[model samples]
Target: MEFNFADRMSDLKGSAIREIFKVIAQPDIISFAGGVPSPDTYPVDALNEISQRLLVGNAAAYLNYGVTNGYPPLIEILKERLTKQGVVKDSDEMMITTGGQQGIDLAAKSILNKGDGLVCENPSFIGALNSFRTYEAELFGVTLQNDGLDVDEFKKTIKENKNIKIAYIIPTFQNPGGVTTSLEKRKKILEICKANGIIIIEDNPYGELRFKGEDVPTIKSLDTDGDTVIYVGSLSKVLSPGMRIGFVVANSKIIGKMEILKQVNDVHTNQFAQALAYEWLKNYDFEEHLEKARLLYKHKCELMLKTMDETFPEFVTYTRPEGGLFILCTINKEGIDSAEVVKACIDKKVAFVPGFTFMVDMTKTSNMFRLNYSTMSDEKIVEGIKILAGVLKTL
Candidate 1:
């Protein structure tokens, strides 16, 4: 049988990182491909206890259908937290979604029309790029510096592309690049977007995972009227990705639209997870857990960076992120093929994602790659880096 798919589906392909995940499932393969949180840090004991107590008494409430906006108690808890961070003034400004990824999709659904231009960092998150592509939006790429997106280039692109409707950014500890946007750069970008009347989708799943640097204020916090920025945050990194709980904070108008769009999507995020998250926040010592997780990641990141500095070829250069799960590395030699390096590494039971996979234009080749140090063991981190260094030497 011949199956017909939508035009957007014609160009949509499975994630290259996820494809790498398949190859690295063998126990021998040490993977740096996935942006997965460490299992060691998960509050399993607490979660198990909560689940049992809830199941014993409140099973029906959790098992039944829930409001599209979210579980009410969860919404209140999250709003309180965000308000403390200066992200939202009230609960009306936010709505829960399936995950940070789903928040990205609903933001695109609510605002982007076909052929609308979406500005993104050149090596942006693959998930967000795919979300925009599904809506048939035109993606324009801007270069990302150590601090953040090139503000001048972003302004130029917005001017050149009058149809550009939204700016998707991961300002703090950005995925794939793992570089935080400076406060000054964030202010400039916000000013430019506000002047251009463009919406800013601030996807910040890793904002709370900082280990080495002072917290930067969120763009959502800087929006004076709560209209210009749609903040997407996740419990996945800090808690559990399996819970599928995330949220969007924006103007009430945007939240209403997203809530409607969300109704047509998954109806609601998981009630059980929402309740669990609420309980965890309300009753548990979350800050202490976060600190412990940060310490683990800092150690792993330092080990990986140290190993790479001592072992990698001098021609290879990489970012030193203050925090977050990934580090972007580039081969200094021009025209160095990333596919050859990836293949060589995989042959030695190591895996990482090539940078081009995260770009708007997958057809373009890059000498860059992204590595994740959060999920691997200290031993595996050392072993994988040494193996990857050996592979690059062969190149």
Candidate 2:
């Protein structure tokens, strides 16, 4: 007998990035498709020490059921850290999530309903987009300029659709595009959302991973009244993704509802992971750890950029990111499908994600693709670029 699924599951497709990742699992494949942090950067020894200490000394805290709002010490630490970063306020509250992805999912679930309008950058994070899609929200794509979301287009989009519930942004070193929204644009986005009463969901997993540029103030920081912003930060990039520890900063009222949602979702994020992360933070030099991760990613980004310059065709253009795991490449060839190129690259033992995965309209995004530089070694990056360059020539 066949089992029927929920109607919402009908329109929801599996993440294209994850699908490509499965295809590139062969040992020969050099994958530029995964948005994963380097395993070499993980603080394994520190985490091991932290885990052992927590279990030996604080077993009750580790093994028992935790508060739905999260492990309080972790939440408190996040509040302190994010307050310094300009996201959390003295008046604001925080909620710990299983990971950054859960923050997105909970935000969508708490705020959105079917056919509710949501504005996101034209090519946004696939996971966040998929999370919003699960709620059957009608998405409006705002064009992303070099500086940020196009203000003129955004104003028009808001004007045309007045019922927008959320405006989601990955302001710093955005996924796939690798474009940071400018400070001026950040303020303007906040103003637009404020005027329209639209909630701004700022996903900032990569903000602390900056290796080459000045830190920009988060849009959430600019919210003096806590009227319009919900900020999500992650330890996935900076500390350890496997720990699955992340936090959300929002008004206490919103966070109250989210805490209930969190309870139902995973009965609170992993207590052992939270305790371990807290122990790691307490025992290690986190700033130094972050700096090391930054340096590693910076070198990888530089290597990929240099390889692209030497090997890719003149018509292929890509972003030069200040930080983060990804760079967007636009192929100049008309009618050349990136999905087909990705399949060809897989055959050649190199893998990258097609751009359509990030776009609301997949049919119109054939000329683009996203490359991630954070998960591979310098040699793997070079080899992957060479293999992809060969594939592009054939295309």
Candidate 3:
């Protein structure tokens, strides 16, 4: 027998980053592709202790079906934590998700209708883009500037398309692009979106990973009235990605609806994972843990930057991110495409993601690629860049 799938399934594309992971699974490959947290940074001992306590002391809570909103104590902790990050107020409501990725999916499902217009950074997070696509939302890409989304282009896009339902952004240490939106641009974006009555979906998975830069206030922080922003936060980077704990901060009204949608999605995120994460948070020094992660990534980023400066062709330009896991490399050679470079890197047992996947238009000329420096060792980082540079020489 043959099976049929929904028409919306055709609108989605498989993640380019996931596809690159399959190519780099070979032991010999040096992967600078996935934005994965380093296993070295996970607080394994703390997690182990937490797990033992939970199993020995509170086994029934983990075994039973849980509330759709999440574990209550976990939700309270998230409210306080997000308040410190400037994503929400003490009064603002929050919901724990399976991961930050699920928060994005739930927001798209709860708020968007078919053909609704959504504006995203030109090179945005592919995961969020895929989530929006699954709901049949028409996506529009706005050019990204060093400071933030191009304000002029953003204004123009809003004017051109009045049907825009949401403007999604990864303002701090953006994925793939590795660029942070400036405070001035953040305020300007807030003004524009507020004026247009557009909701801003702020996905900040890498905010606490800063090593060298001054802290920039999140856009959600600038929202005095709480009418226009939906914020997402993740423990994946700072705590444990394996546990897959993340949360969404929004007005209570919106969060109430999203909680219902999340119930249908997976009942709720794993209760045991929620309890474990809370225990870890309660017992561990989160600031010190974050600092260790920052130092490690900073060293790796410096290695990649130094290698690129010495080895890549003069035409190649890349962003020097102050923090975060990735750097964006654009090979400006007229005939060399990013896809071709990625293929060449794969052939040499080195991997990076081609930039076309991050854009709304696939046919556009893309000489860009993304390199992640968070997961590999210093030796692997240096070796991968050297191998990729050798590939560039041939191009």
Model 1 C-alpha RMSD to native = 1.1
lDDT of 1 by residue, 1-395 (tens): 99887899988989998899899889998999889789998898999989998999879999999999999999899888899999986534789889999999998999999999999888999999999999999999999999999989999999999999999999999999999999999999999999999999999999998999799999989886647899999999999999989999988988899988888898899898999998888889989999998999999999999999999999999999888899999998878878678988898899999988988889878899999999999999999999999888766
- In TM-score terms, which candidate is top? 1
How much RMSD separates candidate 2 from the native structure? 1.2
By lDDT, who's the top model here? 1
Residue-pair clashes per candidate, as listed? 0, 0, 0
Give the Cα lDDT of each candidate.
0.91, 0.87, 0.88
- When summed lDDT is taken over every stretch of 10 residues in candidate 2, the lowest stretch is 359-368
- Please state the error at residue 68 of candidate 3 in Å: 1.1
lDDT (Cα, tens digit) per residue for candidate 3, span 1-395: 77698878976779988988888888899999988889899888888888999999979988788898888888887777777767777556899998899999898888899999999899999989999988999999998777778989998999999889899999988988899999999999999999999999999999989888799999999998756898988988888787899899988888999998988889999999998888777777888888888999898899889988999888889999999888998888787679988987898899989999889776675889999998888899888899998988888
Q: What lDDT does candidate 2 reach at residue 306? A: 98
Q: Which of the two, 1 or 2, has more TM-score?
A: 1
Report the CA-based lDDT of candidate 1 relative to the real structure. Answer: 0.91
